[model samples]
Target: MKVTRTRLTEDEKKAWRQFCQASHASESEMLKMMIRKVSGSVSHTSARNAEPKSEKVTVRLAPGDFKKMDGRAQEEGYLSRTSWTTAVVLAALYREPVLTNEEVNALRQSCRELGAIGRNLNQVARALNIEFREGDRIKREAIEDLAERIEEHRALVFELLNKNMNRWRQ
Candidate 1:
């Protein structure tokens, strides 16, 4: 029998112990199962040997964007942006419908923008409510304009969703 020693954070160690307990498997057995799951037909040793060299890549992100990524990485158990980014890239590569980081960022930005628009519409609705209490005839025109804008936004959202439906299905 061969032994492998690797260091893990206390949280990881606790999680591993819990997993082993739940599965009623020894730690070594669980490790072997994990290796098998990732390796498939390839020998773990051979796969490690065949792995490509890691290359340094530089990326520039806005401060706010970097902070968002850092927070997300921590939540997802990644210690650094590089690791998180690499995992995302690798996962996307294996997925049926791969989207570039730029595309994903654009989608996120669109969602934020849409949310802002929705909030503005809600504020307008509140104002319309107040205007209604005052018996203002101008409230009718404002309501129609607001409804038209909402419909336009809804249609745009549906179009975007429809275009990406096939990609999401996979």
Candidate 2:
């Protein structure tokens, strides 16, 4: 069997030993289990009934630590610690931003508003087309008003996206 080595900080070493002792698993066994778990290859059932693509990892935390982590997660605008942890892990893995709950909601709302503005613009264009087809005079004021509204919404969305990007850059 091939052997692998890793350098761990003092605290991490202590934590690893404690974890192994508490779980009654040898250090090598624990390490292999962690590798399998992270790789999503751990199976608890027979091959016929096992789900090969998905696995669950049960993390045992002390009550105090759980409460603290939950509070910290909520303070960061996450509904739960699990979601916050998942976002953090994924962001780290992908080198992407971990958006807070508020940021996500704001983005969703902005997209919806943008869609509404687009629909309104399409309607106005259709109306203008029909008026032109009928040889009726088009209202300049209506076109100008729609133009201004679209510009305002476009600016707002750009501002929102820029703000989010800046936050991630920092």
Please give, for residues 1-170, the per-residue lDDT of candidate 1 as tens digits: 46789999997887677555433345775687677777784543432234585576788999998998898666644434665676566555665322333334445556776787678777776877777665465556666776777677677656554543443233
Give the per-residue Cα lDDT of candidate 2 at 16: 76
lDDT of 2 by residue, 1-170 (tens): 56889999997887677555433345776677677778898554332233354555578999998997788677766644766666656665777555664665566677787788678767777888777764334446566776787787678767765664454333
Give each model's whole-structure lDDT: 0.60, 0.65
> Relative to the unseen true structure, what is the Cα RMSD of model 1?
15.0
Q: TM-score of every model?
A: 0.31, 0.41
Q: Give the lowest summed-lDDT range of ten residues in model 1.
A: 96-105
